[model samples]
Target: MNKYVLSLLCVSSMSFAATPFIYHDFDEAMQIRNYPKAFALTNRILNYDGKQFFELGRSLYNQYNPSVLPSRSEPIIPKHIHQIWIGGPLPEVFKKYIDTWKQMHPDWGYTLWTDENVRELFPLHNQSYYDESEGMGVKSDLLKWEIIYRFGGVYVDVDYECLQPLDELHHLYDFYTAYQPLDAFFVQLGAALYAAHPEHLILKHCIETIQDDWHHKGAPKKSGPCHFSKSFMAVAGENGSRDIAFPSFYFYPLGSKERVLRRSQWVREGAYAIHHWAMSWMPINTRRQEFRTFENERSSKVWND
Candidate 1:
């Protein structure tokens, strides 16, 4: 076994042990809108005491006073589709899936950015900075914001299989993202498949917040879903009518029991794009093996039925 794989397994073990406590504390913090407490809980779960978590909480608290509604002008059709792969080309199965999307939308531009290219596009001040065991994954999360902010478009994770053209959905909102429900109380707005016009305030807020709080213990908590959810909620509030938020069935349908039980039926009914839950933060070798196994299982189930 590779040293990196061993390290990741150890981290995974630790995470499994800590998950219950993390969930309890996070639920409590989010209930009262105590972002500082939430951040502290995340740090404890991840077993690190860094300045990034506290700083992120403070920055968000100061930045979240949205007194005015964002301008709802005519929506612009985003032209670019951005995907990031830091290690190398995507696996053959994923590439084929992306190609199907390209064939469906020939006019749309696709850009696959690598690690060096991402760093060149968005330079970090501290070259030695690292976040979590999967540092590159954190960088990938940050890169998505910079790329989308610079050139307005949809940023999709490569693992997501695009089932149809997003042109119609693109015209519906100036900015949009789907929900990944954490529990009954918390609905985390996902970053996997989102579209926005250049310089959208919510996207701007996400980018700025990540930049200020770049060095946290956990990437997902600091700059991934948690950060995006908080920033979005701050600007959009709890009002469902304010922004275009898709139900989980549209973007993240794989994890649900209903979807797993009625896989084919669910796939045919909705789901413009399906997130594979690639678990990209794991070691590359581990994730690649898991991806292959998952794809095989899904394909067998979906096709055989």
Candidate 2:
């Protein structure tokens, strides 16, 4: 069943109804550095079943740090978000975005899934980071997609700023993604998207099918769909409910020929989210022509609003 289809009212009732299952993993604990909280939350979730194995793992974790418990109340939100997972390491900067989100939508609530505690409950055979770009015979990016298939809710890059209510995206489609193609032209990345939607098969397939070739070819020479996560949409096209692609201005600004081309499209289309894949805390290029799109849009009524 499409969980979100349950009308906002019904979703609210079941948002935190089911306790998440857990597994045991030592590496995850070290990486996330939050073993105590993870173990404590697990015990609370599995307290009713009295499962022997889970009990043992919970005991081990608790022995190390006795003060952990399931978040009595997940930060409240308007609807139920099945499972929200963040793939990378949790850094301090990311917390600012979370705070921004909370400030923007006080009622919105969602749980965060991290590798840190997941392995403790459900152990996986392979858990390490690898980076390979195009034709390098590397499947590193696949990590993000794997999580998307199993979870739902919004998946955003740590660098992205929460500018508006996520609820607004509910009507657009089952998925949403940034669009950045290389060409010194324009394209979006897949850092932000709605996952756990059945339609996401399109994105999953696109990544598996196109990533190697796109990376090998590099930017400027790459085709539109070949760009990877940026254009990857929910396979379920427009079915009364469909995935929509927002403009770059929402995330990335026009700062160069590449920026201009990419941001121009979104400028004309007027996007809801701006991707900062190429531009993080610093500017991409100094050419005023390039920054024009992002700069002008940054001060516009749309940006201020």
Global lDDT of model 1: 0.54
* Model 1 poorest ten-residue lDDT run: 17-26
Instruction: List clash counts for every candidate, in order.
Output: 0, 34
RMSD of 2: 21.5
lDDT of model 1, residue 180: 56
lDDT of 1 by residue, 8-63 (tens): 33333332211110111222222335233534554455334323433333333233
What are the clashing pairs of model 1? none
User: Against the correct fold, how does model 1 do in TM-score?
Assistant: 0.62
- Per-model CA lDDT versus the true structure: 0.54, 0.35
Error of 2 at 183 (Å): 9.0
> Could you say which candidate leads in TM-score?
1
Instruction: Give model 2's TM-score versus the native structure.
Output: 0.43
